[model samples]
Target: MLGIGIVGLGYWGPNLVRNFSAAAEAEVRCVADRDAARLQKIHSLYPAVDLLSEATEVFQRSDIDAVVLATPINTHFPLAKMALEAGKHVLVEKPLATSRAEVLELMEIADRKGLQLMVDHTFLYTGAVQKIKSLVDSGELGELQYFDSTRINLGLFNPNWSVIWDLAVHDLSIFDYISSGKKPVAVSATGISHTQMGIEDIAYISLFFNDSTIAHITSSWISPVKIRKTMIGGSKKMVIYDDVEPTEKIKIYDSGFSVSSPEDMHRWLVDYRFGDIAIPKIAQTEALLGVAQDFVSAIVRGTRPISDRESGLNVVTILEAAQQSVKQRGQTVSLV
Candidate 1:
């Protein structure tokens, strides 16, 4: 089994530990956190696993084959860089790094060391997203025209990053994965800081593609109700994925309209077509477990993971552009 060390014991860290421990091809050998209480808790639960207050021990240990980082956004680059430089494969949480340059630097080190660098864009491994990818690839949803997403919740704000970096990164990664390598030409974004921390609590972002395909992401930390929803429209069919639903989370609508020119001048004809809606049954599985397995497989088999470094870079590029646009008061930023 591949020995794994996890850094960070906060919010998402525990989940990573659980999933990596349950992975058949990997073992959790050590955990590190700044909080002594958190380390004590981990020790109580996993006494055999080593615990450290400083993460340097994890990078120094020869027994660890890989390191998984679930720390703050700002700490990602340095920690991942240290792990890669230590001749160990690294898996980090979403967005990879704050800037494209940081991501590129990490990529260079991993490439030079022949180590696997994977990002934990966990939603890409979900049944709903996988099904959407299959349909889009199969042309069932012919020529995807738009992707709209709304992810909002109350009071999970971070001190280091804005709401877009916190929430919309998920949708951005999803858009990047299901789009199958389609690159956007430009981006426009607007946001506001409602709290004293000076970080955005609400934001909206729009992306433009070369083919005129568009994507919009709405994220907020001020919503009274939590919602996780996305809509994908294509030439032939459309999909509605509601993650909050208990069952039948994926619904496809065979509905569309078409327009044609008329014989008379200044006149046109339009037709609307409505067909039966189909709800596809999605296979239920733990997405984090899938992420852990993929990371292990990438390390062992020398295969690229679904959420590889390039995909993470793609998401970061868009995010960087979006942040610039936000700073310019919603000015459109060209990605070209």
Candidate 2:
């Protein structure tokens, strides 16, 4: 059994602890939080679970075979590096690190130590997303044209990172996974900060890829109501994945544009073909739970996670570039 140590008991930490504790292959050995009151509260709920104030104490214990980091964005790099160096497998939340160099360093350390390093990109493990991946992989999304997404919420603001890192990272990771091996060539972005927090509350990012593929992502935390939707358009078909919907969460539309006749030239008009819309029977499972379970499986099988370090690195690399672009007033940034 993998003995796990959980760091940070803030917003997302408890979910990790609960899921990890429930996984059969792993056991939550201890949990650490800086706030003593929060630790007491957790101890009150999970009486048998060990709780501590200092995060370093978890690393000091030999019983911990792995560490799960649910800390803030800035703390991810150092905490993950420390955990890996302590000879423990590490699982960190999304955007693995703030910078590309930090990601490379973490990869090197984990590789040298022959340890597993996983990132919690929770959405990728979702039933809807997995089905979408299968559809794309099976050529149902044929010759991808563009990916457009809009993710907005009222306010779960962060002081460290802008809206791009806070919100668009999810779509970026999804696009990365869905696009397979396609690397983005260039990008442009713009953002606005409504508050005095010094970080952006809204942003729009455009990603340019080789060939005809391109993607646009818009994220904001200042919206009135939450909206989570993504559309992937292709030559053959199109897809609409809406998390806000209950019945039609994922709808694959067998409808697209087609040229009527090349001979007509200027007279020729684009045809709109509409056919079947499939929801592709999907299993009901919590995304975070699936991610936690997958982490354990990857550890046991000695395999890289689906949303592994490399995937997280790619997302962070884009985020870094986008941040730079935002600062430069949406000047096109090149990834190559």
Candidate 3:
């Protein structure tokens, strides 16, 4: 069994503890949090696991082979670097780091140490997304056309990062995974702050790809109601992914339009094909568990995971460009 240590039991840490506790090929040996109540709460569930007050203690443990970080956005780079320097495999929560330089440095460390460096992009492990990847790769959704997404929820604002960093990362990871060969070349974004923190609470991002493909993401922390929906449109079919829907998360619509022969150059006929909507069944499994399993397996088997450092780089690249675009008042930012 691979021994694991977790740091930061804030918003998303407890969930990681729960999943890693139940995950395959791994065991939570130690966990640390500055919040005494958080440590006590986790101790209540896991009496056998060691609890520490300082995060540095997690890296000092001799038995722990891997470290999982759920710290704030700014602390990811330093904590992960410390773990890697101590010869421990590391898993960090999304975006990898605040800037590309930090991520590249962490990648360099992990490479030198020959350790697994993974990002906890939990959405990439979801059954619905995995199914969507299959559909996309199988040519079920003909030539890719567009990816439009809206991920908005209420009242979970962060002082460190804006809505674009907090929310759009998910959609970008999903897009990067599903659209294999097609990558965005440029990005444009706009956002506004609604609180005294001067952090953006709402944003809109548009991505331009080399081909005819494009993507638009609307992310907000001010929505009255929660919405996790995405549409992947192609020439032959379209997909509707409603993450909030428990049962019918993925619905494939076999409907699209086609161009008819043009008798006159200016007057071309159009035909619309409306076919049946197919709802493919998705396995009901917690995505975090898959993340835990992949982390452990990659460490043991010496294989790069699905959410590897390279994929994490892709997500971070777009995030950096998008944030710059927002700062420039929706000026298009070149990614390449």
**If scored against the real structure, what TM-score would every candidate get?**
0.98, 0.97, 0.98
For residues 61-106, could you state the per-residue lDDT of candidate 1 as single tens digits?
9999999999999999999999999898999998799999999999
lDDT of 3 at 297: 92
Kindly list the per-residue Cα lDDT of model 3 for residues 11-108, writing each as its tens digit: 89999999999988889999999999999999999999999988789998899999999999999999999999999999999979988889999999
Question: Worst lDDT window (10 residues) for model 1?
Answer: 257-266
Model 3, residue 269: distance off in Å is 1.9
lDDT of 2 by residue, 1-336 (tens): 999999999989999988997888898989999998878877887888899887789988999999999999999999999999999989999879999999999999999999999888888988888888888899978888999999999989888788898889999999989877578999999998988887999999999987899899999999999999999998898999998987678989999988777675678878889999887777678888888888898888876678888789889999999999999989999999
RMSD of 3: 1.1
Worst 10 residues of 3 by lDDT: 176-185
Q: Which ten contiguous residues of candidate 2 have the minimum total lDDT?
A: 260-269
Ranking by TM-score: 1, 3, 2
